[model samples]
Target: MSEHGGDRARAEAWLGQDPDPETRAELRALLDDPAALADRFGAKLEFGTAGLRGELGAGPNRMNRVTVMRAAAGLASVLTSRDDLRESSGGVSVVIGYDARHKSDVFAEDSAAVLTGAGVTVHLMPRPLPTPVLAYAVRHLGCAAGIMVTASHNPPRDNGYKVYWEDGAQIIPPLDQEISTAIDAVGRVDELPRGTDWRVLDEAVVEAYLRSLARLPLGTARDLTAAYTPLHGVGGAVLAQAFAWCGFPEPDVVAEQAAPDPDFPTVAFPNPEEPGAMDLALALGKGRDLVIANDPDADRCAVAAGGRMLTGDEVGGLLAEYVLRHTDGSDRLVATTIVSSSLLRAIAAEHGVRYAETLTGFKWIMKAGTDRDRLVYGYEEALGYSVGGDDGVPVHDKDGIGTALMVAAMAASAKESGGTLLDLLDDQARRYGLHATAQLSVRVEDLSVIADAMARLRESPPGELAGRTVTEVDDLAEGLDGLPPADVVRLRLSDGGRVIVRPSGTEPKLKCYLEVVVPVTSSPEEARTRATGDLTALREAVADALGL
Candidate 1:
């Protein structure tokens, strides 16, 4: 008997139901290779709050036609079982969208078919669109659910299936587990009923989403010269149209990445946070007032100004200040994640607006406040922002296109005042102290390395870091500060420096978020210098303690 004897049976079963000929051939080849067969069939991709994401391949463990089909059917089963949802919505319907990744359109089509076959009405996007558009469509079309086929900033050969509930935010908690259970119960892809009678949406859906952007409270100063890049993804055309519609000058887009290219040839990784990912865009931004880059699906926004890429926390602070000043709402709320800098909370306090800190990701950011308090603005340290319109949150997810418009508007207003974004940062420092932030990430080949490091810390935590006394240690897995339980640990120094360590939800990396707040007693520049030094020392101490 072979070591992969069980996997052989699973692989053969998967091969029989896989709809894609490419994947079927790959699986047939893997059958004779025991190692590859076991890898493909050892375990399935676990679906959770974020939905399914993995390398594109031919087995249950990888993201492929069969995997997507099972996920879609599972979601459909859950939606159909919701009698209350059907009664409230008149019927269960879903809006489906996809990006330009490999087989994204096919996956979208298959999802629509599966859902429709399961007696759920499907309104599918006419073409590949940004993930935010789908999020907005879920609410605009009054859908019970939404699905987007995109891996966001992942590498070329990766793809994903992201689920959004009727509230237009990513699914969370019990719902995710319920859908996962349904997926596990799914027997075979070929046996799952599929239909092609779903409705294909028109340009009206896209136009409606754009109209919501126009409602953003942008000032009249639209004289900003900007450079933009979509990082060889699907955001370029829509972002251009959004800028023009909002009365801003058309930005100088990087020619190499102006069009949607799934291969993402210009950069090693399509994500703007990756090293050298924005090199070309930054080069083009030399003489521009601002530079903007969006991830592949345009769900996250990154900005550069004065030839420097501003950290996500800086952008969040600026945008929070801008929105609070321009918009008029008595019960407005601003929010950030636990890993993000605490600057927004200070800004919120100054403005007397409600504030919250949630677990990382826009899913938590979007659900920051209660129904009484509207979420006027929310952001995370990972370049994701969800800014509310004049009415309410038009898109209840991270919208890079909407954020680009706001960034342009803010830049124009600042330029008109004869200052740059750097000046605004200095002002923020003087008013609210220098809240400097940095990150330390360790990418691992084996996931257990991360588990081992975490366990080591939990068992024997360092009493001090960087010569500062460890005033408090928060085991986030025990759920601190009214937030849900998470695989995270936070260390707070007596001097007010802080460190948070957690496994990256989207990648194979363990990350540490560092913050050092310094009072601006001297000049803002001097305070920044001191804060930077403290953060560096803190980073080194954390690295030594982790022993990774």
Candidate 2:
């Protein structure tokens, strides 16, 4: 048989066994169309550290009932095989949550049934909720595992299944590899188990998460109006409830993108970081004290205040200062991704706290916190943040809802003192020179192309970037600063700026993070323009080096 023929055969076989008539019919329709079949069955959907995520279709390469069931069965098998997990709980317990994506609820139910059939306990969220709520439930319910059915800012046709360990963070290294191996071992869709008691999750889990967020030492609450947008995702209602409970004025909602919609009609991508994602919110939010936006699943947040969208670095720096000041100089540490600006390190030093940098994912942040007993707060350049000690009740995963509430509290307190978030930021800049950060992403058609680019760069790295001498180059894969090996390269520049480049593990893109810190003067606007110009030059040099 030809490669395409074999793929069709496999897909047809799975569809033949699928119990859902609708799914089966969908598969049959695709099978008759050569182009559709080729696209659907081109390859098996990869189970990476982020688990399965792609457009939904009737092939192994897409997210569908069969693929979701297979991933659940694999997770069940891996959990059962683990001595620690099996001994702690006679059968594994998994809490599943879904968003407003197409078939998200169906996929969540499918995962529950498969796990239940494997003799595991299944708790399903009763309604569509943010991904962080599910992460909180895993720890609150004392479950051994968790799964969130979401695509999180991807286009309408895409969906995803993200797995989490009991700790509430995305699965890392060995566990991810083990789950992938188990998933690959399943030869047929029928190999998965079926039918077990799946109950709706209890309501207390959500309340517990909110209570935890309220524990942050907010100096004082003051009346401050704000605007919020969920980007047509699943975060609106619950986040509103959180703000209300925390004593902040109800936020003005961006009507167009207020409700959950799989189609995400208003934005090209549902992500708040996208260029125009917050345009609607900004348009509706004139004269507001703040504007807060959460990604589809609410695991990340972006804030706009004082007619400016705060960069993730600026947000991290402000949050670090708030947490450290509230803690009153205790031995706590602030953690950030390596690609993030080093402004936090300077802030930490002034506050007499430690600052550590991990790889460019929350997984690394969680692991770093777990290893050190002093993880007060953690953040990434991608708008993900985790507040609370590592040993806290909430899981280590980022929670945008939680972060929003914290920010509101901080904002309210600042309002009482006649200050703004920007004021706090300016103080930090004055204390620790002005640090400006920016990122450039080069999307590609294939993952292998990125790997090839990395290999080529390693073979012969450029001696200079943007006409500045390269002071030093460090291969992160060789263990930098006692950290684990990662596929990244850092270049220190003669102008005291730095550039870090790495292929995104979860997406088909190569990302470049550039940062330059210059001394602040009376004319802050001039400094910002100069720093931005330098960053633009660095981006061009990186593009040239990659031949993009």
Task: Give one digit per residue, the lDDT tens place, for model 1 in 1-548.
Answer: 65688889888877778889999988887788988987878888999888999899988889998899999999998999988876874699999999999999999999998999998999999999999999999999999999999999999999999999999999989899999999999988899888889999999999999999999988899888889999989999899899989899999999999889889999999999999999999999999999999999999999999999999999999999999998777788888999999889899999999999999888888877788988889899889998875576789999999999999988999999999888999999999888899999999999999999899889988999988998888998979888999999998878676899999987789999999889899899899788888988988989889987
The candidate scoring highest on lDDT is: 1
Q: List per-prediction Cα lDDT, in the order shown.
A: 0.91, 0.83
Residue 87's C-alpha lDDT in candidate 1?
A: 80
lDDT of 1: 0.91
RMSD of 1: 1.5
Candidate 2 structure, TM-score to reference: 0.95
Candidate 2 on 1-548: residue-level lDDT in tens?
Answer: 98768767877787776766776888887776767777777778889888889988777778888889889989999988878877773467899999999999999998999898888889999899999998888887888989999998788999999998988889888789899999988766676668767888666778887887777665567578898999988899989888776777789999988888889998888888888999988877788778999999999999988888999988988887777777743557788888988887888888887778887778778777444456778888788888763333254788899888878877877877898888877777777877889988889998887888788778778899988888898898888996789899888888677889899876789988888876778656667777889889888998888777
Looking at model 1, the pairs that clash are: none
